[model samples]
Target: MAAEFDTLAEWTAQVATDLGSSFKIPAACRGSGSLAVLDWLIDELHLSHGGSLLDCGAGMGGPAAYAVRQRSVRPLLVEPERGACRAARSLFGHPVVRASALALPVGDDSFDAAWSLGVLCTVPDQLALLTELRRVVRPTGRIGLLVFVARSSEPFPHPDGNHFPTEARLLSLVEKAGLGIEDWRGTEEMAGPTPEWQSRVEKVTAELADRHRGQRAWQLAERQSQLIGQLLADSTVTGELLTLRRR
Candidate 1:
């Protein structure tokens, strides 16, 4: 039988099944445009067999594993969280490095391409993260990123205390880190508020609360959903997908 889903939806649904409801990808990341994003990443990075791809943050290993299987690319996943690293290693069977994005353990020019999804916002030092990525990836190597960017300087309340940088600030950081932005897409253009997303969020939250007994994971899930919903509702912060090349 054909795969049930070709995008984040299937992967996240499965994650929710395995780790209760708290581990699912946010509704904001599951949309019709997700397949297009995957296609763009493959095409822009020119992924192929034997080429090394670095998955920064590498959350749950779903998207990275999907990309590797789809393109036959070798991947080295770097995740700071031990739980996430374990999950990635077990699920993808890919080599995983438990390290921070600011300090990648890989040697210089180790990867042909690198990408991160919904991770940049969690990083406090964008330049450090991007610099590490640039150092690890070969010169002129392609980089693709999808980040939640702020529309203003005011910090957005988040469970992770992540920095939601303004578009200009984020672009500046990328350029400063010696990467050139080749193209960009905004949230509305990528995955705006999808119909039924609210219901999905409610269901996930309720399920997580039940399973985790409203513990840390459940609370985090609820807060994350609230943040995403607010971002979508106010249009204050938007998801930005960028195609970049290391310089």
Candidate 2:
């Protein structure tokens, strides 16, 4: 995945420039697309210096590394994927525990706060994931989540066969999980899909197709990005950030 590495390298450089920090980001841990929103979510957590945070679906550990270095928050990354778990340790020496979000391996009240980036929508059992998040974090711990939700009843195709919950369904799940809503808002006002986002998706799609014509991961990422772009363009899907506190 030369293209993936190249894109990540470029983005990391830009982030370094914008933030004025020379913290090196590993390419293997960088997720696709603009990660500008990551900073906002980190800020939402209001983590104190040297506090611990749980990173649900911690992919590649790039974000975890950045969190530790920049935010000064000790992060425990939990990722189920074997490759990603290894990459996190190998690339950044970030502490990683291999586990599913539905059932975190850590003990109860283990972290000061927790956050998940772009992972909640893909889970088939959102309530279970929410419950687990509540379980692992301490009472009154803040949780920051970024997800894409259905703007209408229209079905959106996803590679993982997961459906986006409506606003009401999400609220119900939050209540069921015993999480108090600290804040909820649409991300469009803060960061909507721009031409640059579309261009980057297209570039990544083409690169994936050229590199691996028949690979499932390549095909899935390409198709998912296309559908998301379409849904975003038509306003059928909305990106959201939710802040919750364990009760």
User: Candidate 1: worst 10 consecutive residues by lDDT?
Assistant: 1-10
TM-score of each: 0.79, 0.78
Error of 2 at 9 (Å): 14
lDDT of 1 at 224: 58
Q: Point to the candidate with the largest lDDT.
A: 2
- Each model's lDDT: 0.68, 0.69
Candidate achieving the largest TM-score: 1
Give the per-residue lDDT digits (tens) of candidate 2, residues 74-187.
999897766566656655677888888898998999889998876788788999999999988888688988778887766656435446888888889999999988887677
Please list all clashing residue pairs in model 2, or write none if there are none: none
- Ten contiguous residues with the weakest lDDT in model 2: 1-10
RMSD of each candidate? 6.7, 5.6
Candidate 2: lDDT over CA atoms? Answer: 0.69
